[model samples]
Target: MNKVSQILVGGALGLSILTAASAADPKPQDTVDYRKSVYTIIGWNFAPIGAMMKGEVPFDAAAVVRHAQYVEMMSKAAPEGFTKGSGPDAVKDTEAKPEIWTNWDKFEAKMNDFQQEAAKLTEVAKGGNEGAIKAQFGKTAETCKACHKAFRKD
Candidate 1:
């Protein structure tokens, strides 16, 4: 082959190998599983923040501020990670409920609302005002309550 032909063939071969590598990788379901693991980690890490917010634990503004990002992240994350059996057994033992799956539009709306509230809470917390944080925390908590009431198992 001419030099130019060799270069072209090499580029094509590299592209083909890249495509094959990606195709051999895990599918969306596997990706979903990975995201669920991340969600679990975020949940565990945020427990302290939750405790502080509710005053069960001592107030730690820094910790609350740090974990607020995870709340926003998990809230904004796609629901693919929330598949029927994707969570911890304690919280994940049951199906996500037929209503959640069947009425996906409403479920998604609630998720979006929660995400917005979390973002608002993060903003308020970042300002370092306990009063504002408490108020916004209430709003954020209400979002969780609303969604859980509608979609989560008792």
Candidate 2:
């Protein structure tokens, strides 16, 4: 083939491979694991912040802001983790309820609530005011509980 034709063919082949890879469905276990990891990241950051807010531990301003930021970042990616086949019925041992799929609009609204509240909490934490962070922290935590109450199971 001529040089231009060869370039076009190579680019088309690369594009096809990329498209196929992106379109391939994830395995059920992989979906479960990914969703778990995303939640774990949120929980890991949230624990210390909750402790600080509740005075169960001495309030560390830096840690509060740090962890809040982590939650905010992870929250942005949280929804995508709940892919089409990642619901409870798709896999064993998942705490996510089938209601998440059935009541998807409600479930999604709750998820968005967390995203917004987490963002607010992130801003509050950055301000480093214990009072504001404490108040917003409660709001943020409530969002989690709301979603859990509706979607998550024991």
Candidate 3:
């Protein structure tokens, strides 16, 4: 009915889907598919915020908060997507590099950074302070760049 209610409902549905995916004995390809879908959803919610932040689109605090919520949720959801045996070698269609499985600790640290920054971005967005939101967005984007640089392939 309301925006908050919609977010909660949507998030609950996403969590349920994630739970279902993890509960089953997924094939390697299936795991890859799941992770790809997760990232796609993250990118979907993330692009508009990025455009707004870059001044390519008008800044709307309400839109920023909504997008930040999805980004934060997906950042938390992302770890599950990087399961063992789902790397590019196994999947063949992912941009995920071998270092993800080989240098797991470092990759995990980057992921943690992303999750923390994403959460912080959501909090900053809720405050309706453009400067703080922009700063947090930069921090969150840095985490993404760090992770992508270390673990993802071009």
Candidate 4:
């Protein structure tokens, strides 16, 4: 199969496993914790690429590729954290808005957008072109912002 198909299959499998785990876990807190952990890893890996793109740090093609890989992986891993019972009503501390569940289709679309853009970013980063990587980063960040605006709280 092609790389995109492979990633889609892997992501689907990962999501199912996570959904099962969420179902098995006894508390909403467990799901919340899992969600938090996944996002933390994503943000952690995503920051340096933004720094490089912004000129806060010298551009490093290798580092961009490395960070992009993690971002892409975490994007795939993200679905596991958003199972049904993990919303604001169940876990008061989460920044995830209730609409994530209420508007599940929209939220899922945003998540898919993120996953696709992140995958594209990883592939573009591999090319080692700063300009192209920067553009891809913007696209990925736009997906994040769209999701956050519609589904997350400040």
If scored against the real structure, what TM-score would every candidate get? 0.65, 0.81, 0.82, 0.83
lDDT score of model 4? 0.87
Quantify all predictions' global Cα lDDT against the true fold.
0.68, 0.83, 0.83, 0.87
- The residue-level lDDT of candidate 2 at 77 comes to 83
> Candidate 3's residue-wise lDDT over 9-72, tens digit each?
5354567334333346666776777777778888898889889878999999999999999999
66-122 in candidate 2: lDDT tens per residue?
A: 999999998898777787787767788799898888889999999999999999998
Pick the winner on TM-score between candidates 1 and 4. Answer: 4
> On lDDT, who's better, 1 or 3?
3
- lDDT per residue for candidate 1 within 1-154, as digits (tens), equals 4323533553544673333323455444444455556657657655776677678988878777888888887776646556654433324344345577678899889989988988987787788887788888778878878987997667
Q: Model 1 segments beyond 4 Å from truth?
A: 1-39, 82-94
Tens digits of per-residue lDDT, candidate 4, 1-154, equal 5323433553545663333333455368777877788889989999999999999999999999999999999999888889898888887899999899999999999999999999999999999999999999999999999999999999
Q: Model 2 clash pairs?
A: none
Q: What TM-score, to 2 decimals, does candidate 2 have?
A: 0.81
Predictions: Cα RMSD each: 9.4, 7.6, 7.5, 9.1
Error of 1 at 71 (Å): 0.9
Worst 10-residue lDDT window for candidate 1 reads: 16-25
**CA shift of 16, model 4, Å:** 24
